[model samples]
Target: MAALADAEHRLGRGLPDDLRQLLLECDGIIGHTAVDTVWSVEQIVAQNLLFRTDSSFAQLYMSFDALLFFGDNGGGDQFAFVQTPQRPDIFVWEHETDSRRWVAGDLRDYLGRSLAEGGDAWYQ
Candidate 1:
């Protein structure tokens, strides 16, 4: 939990409380029958940083400064938050189309829907 806080502090902002609690419970989740995994705090920071600097992504989307990536769908698609308000909503970034779509209104909803659907693939 301290590690998560440290990562958030380094990023200069806090994660949504639901996400913080989720991370505290488990560093990340491995899909029941899928290869996808939500990233740990460290992994999230690293992945966000990597994407933030990618030249191609920058050319297309300006910047990832307002986003915080949390997971990936094993096939290259990413799950993230838009970083607004008290509870950040979930969005999925499709690798093939280079587009993003809202998945859930909040972390709890995302988890429930993702689990109910069996895995992250349902969103794809």
Candidate 2:
């Protein structure tokens, strides 16, 4: 837990609200019984499980003001993005990483791309 928090602080990014809430529960900040889903991100990161999805195009949400997705970008190695969920659809470039396969898409790359000049589209 400390490792995860430190990594998040040093990198300055977080999982989607829903995922974070689940983590908080695991951290004893909330009741574990509150969780309804069977898959936990913690387990994924710990290599206890794999992504349970129907397709390779996985949908990931972040607490940060950016939209990120990681998977094969049509071909080659799995690609990563820090994209704007809005018109113009500005996106950030990033590389793939083991941690990103669960939490972030190479935080360094996404952090740079997600910090462009624009208000969050989520509120718009």
Best by TM-score: 1
Q: Write the per-residue lDDT of candidate 1 for residues 1-124, one digit (tens) a residue.
A: 6898788877778877777888998888877566445778898878887887888878877467777889877888888888754446898888777787898888877777777756558775
lDDT of 2 by residue, 55-115 (tens): 3434442232343232222222222234333222223222242233322334343333323
Quality of model 1 by C-alpha lDDT: 0.78
Which 10 residues in a row give candidate 2 its minimum summed lDDT?
Answer: 28-37
Total residue pair clashes for candidate 2: 1
Error of 1 at 2 (Å): 2.2
Let me know the TM-score candidate 2 reaches against the reference structure. Answer: 0.24
Worst 10 residues of 1 by lDDT: 30-39
Best by lDDT: 1
